[model samples]
Target: MTFSIVGRCPETGQLGIAISSSSIAVGARCPWARAGVGVVATQNVTLPALGPQVLDLLEHDQLEPAAAVERALNANGWSEYRQVTTIDAQGRTAFFTGKEALGVHHALAGEQCVAAGNMLASIEVTAAMVHAFENAAGLLADRLLAAMHAATDAGGEAGPVHSAALKIVGDHTWPIADLRVDWADEDPIGQLDTLWQAYRPQMQDYLTRALNPTLAPSYGVPGDE
Candidate 1:
């Protein structure tokens, strides 16, 4: 029901996740990331809490991606229906697709990324995403969009996808870029891309405000104008 990419940008050392699903509000339900820690995408039958639990193991327990994923799965009784992918800061990665997953499910890893999908129209979609993310140019967000486009180009999920999300963690506890399309009948992924583009220019300003308001730029909204 979902396809996602969890990646560590080799150039920036940033971690993020780009995900889409046929289900509603996949943004709030699937992706999770921690600054200087790791990223997780938990889908398929979809246990939302598993995302944070995996990150907890990575951040607090100081476990690597594989160990953290294994521990999280072992602790849960519902592993058989979940497909979760995890990637740590060091480019270490691991994935699990339970026996109860949908149509065509698979996970593939790249130099600093992992792509996974369940109920996919084609198994090659995940591979295509990894290739796109690895070979694409520009910022981490752009590369994530490229990988998402690759998945759709290769025939994404078995059904029409309705929601999408992109979450990137930098130096703060909050995401540097958290963009989501909770649901869209037409094109959620495209909506996500557009939202990211609109936010890109203001991203730095917001971060500056968070770290040092005196140096941050003006709001440029109605009141400021």
Candidate 2:
């Protein structure tokens, strides 16, 4: 029981995914992205392997999102139980909600994004997510957060969502942001947003430290002096 958005920033060429679910640790199982490649969200009886398989096709096989999704589905006998959405580096997108996907499922493909949901309060949840992502301002992460908020406002999962995740990949192999709330009785999206606000300022610093420790600023921890 999950809803998610996988999108590319046209201006920055960054790729990211924001997702939430009634299940725990949705991040570890659902969203996947590769820098300069694409993003994928696999849910509804999620086959975790499909996320990486789709990315490999996009990155090395020169396959577009639609073709890659088709290939991945064909390789799995349980495809009919899975729901997947993908967006390529060029903004081409594709999605599928298997016939066996849970209640009130829908998938929407937008300009540079694709959203999917299963066991949802309503089909409009996916549509709301895409609309918010397309119109929201600020950084890609903020836009993604806005989309999640819209999904929740539109009706969210059929049941209470206990977990949420936000992930973004930029030019480097490592992710620029990877935040998750494995489980929360309250608002997981709000928790994720708070983590993003705290992490945003230090994002570039972390990258700088990795690339050039000497040029990076002080750690700012108690014992750094």
Candidate 3:
């Protein structure tokens, strides 16, 4: 029902996440990230608490992503239907899909990321997402978007994508950019890509201003200025 990317921006040294789902308001349910801490995507039978708790544990010096995931799962009151992925500050990653998770499919972890998507037509979607995240060389946001695009190309959620979101935390906890269409006529992933491109410049300006407001104001088309 959902596809998401959770990762660290290699260039900006920022932690971020992006997600889309056929379900409404996927933003409210799918992605979570904390700069200088970690990222988590708790989907399928989602667990809301895993979002904050994983970052909490990582901030406490819990560097082993697998251990952090295990502890989080253990504490989850609803584990049977949950699917979770956690990436710590060190880029260590881990994932878990419960027995009762939709379609019963799970995923594996690699160097800096983990991925899981249930109710997918094939395992290739999840595999391709993780591969893109691991192999792509660029900013974390680009890499994360690539992972999501790969999954969409690989057949996506075995259904439609209705809602999408991107969350990045840096020196500031507030999202540099966040948008959720909630519903779209078609090609929601493509719509998300368009929104990302349209928003990137403004987001960059916001971050720059936050870091040092003395920098020149964002220059764009005369109308936008």
Candidate 4:
């Protein structure tokens, strides 16, 4: 009941994932990324732990995306019910769609990205996502958002998606952008886009505050006045 794209910005080495699902709070369980490591999207009977486990292998163990995915599945008894995709820092990609995955499932691996979907309106959903991500020009987040929009436009989940998420990590351990519409009555993707627009200008500010509060600008809060 989910579709997602994981991509890397070659210019900045940023990793990002955008996803939407028929389930609520999909963001909390599906996407994971570590700066300078990789990104993972685990869904369809998702083992949330698998997301971090894959990243650990990619980052600490120096495993490529495919090898990390292989090791991850080798360690799990429930691999047959899962759908996962990983994109490493070097843009190496790997994906698995279990036979037990619900409904129609498909995946696409591209230059610096991977897209996957289960319980989709059609297998073409993943393809559309990949195309949009590769062709779109702009910030990494915007390209990711475009891919999510394309997925929905090309027939996303088998049912209406109630939640959406966009996550990106740059050089820092913290995410440069993390936006989610945990449950929305309307279009979760659109809501996520709005959140990104609102957050983008402050993204560098927040990072600066974290790395050097002395040089950080005002908070624009009442106390700062």
The best candidate by TM-score is 2
Per candidate, the number of residue pairs that clash is 0, 0, 0, 0
CA shift at 31, candidate 3, in angstroms?
Answer: 0.9
Q: Tens digit of lDDT per residue, candidate 3, span 1-225?
A: 876767775556677777887788888877888767888998887777888877787778554777777788788767878888877666777787888878636575655667778888688887898888888876677777888888888888887788887777776777676766678868777787788878876877777777897884857758544
TM-score of 2: 0.98
Q: How do all the candidates rank in terms of lDDT, highest first?
A: 2, 4, 1, 3
Off by over 4 Å in 1: 222-225
Q: What TM-score fits each model?
A: 0.97, 0.98, 0.87, 0.97
Worst 10 residues of 2 by lDDT: 216-225
Query: Which residue pairs collide, candidate 4?
Result: none
- Candidate 2: tens digits of C-alpha lDDT, residues 163-208: 9999999999999999999999989999999999999999998899
lDDT of every predicted structure (CA atoms) = 0.92, 0.93, 0.77, 0.92
Task: Give candidate 2's error at residue 117 in angstroms.
Answer: 0.3
lDDT pick, better of 2 and 3: 2
Cα lDDT of model 4 by residue, 154-224, tens digit: 98888899999999999988898999999998899999999999999999988988999787889778876
Worst 10 residues of 3 by lDDT: 103-112
Please give, for residues 48-76, the per-residue lDDT of candidate 1 as tens digits: 88889998999899998888888999898
For lDDT, candidate 2 versus 4, the one ahead is: 2
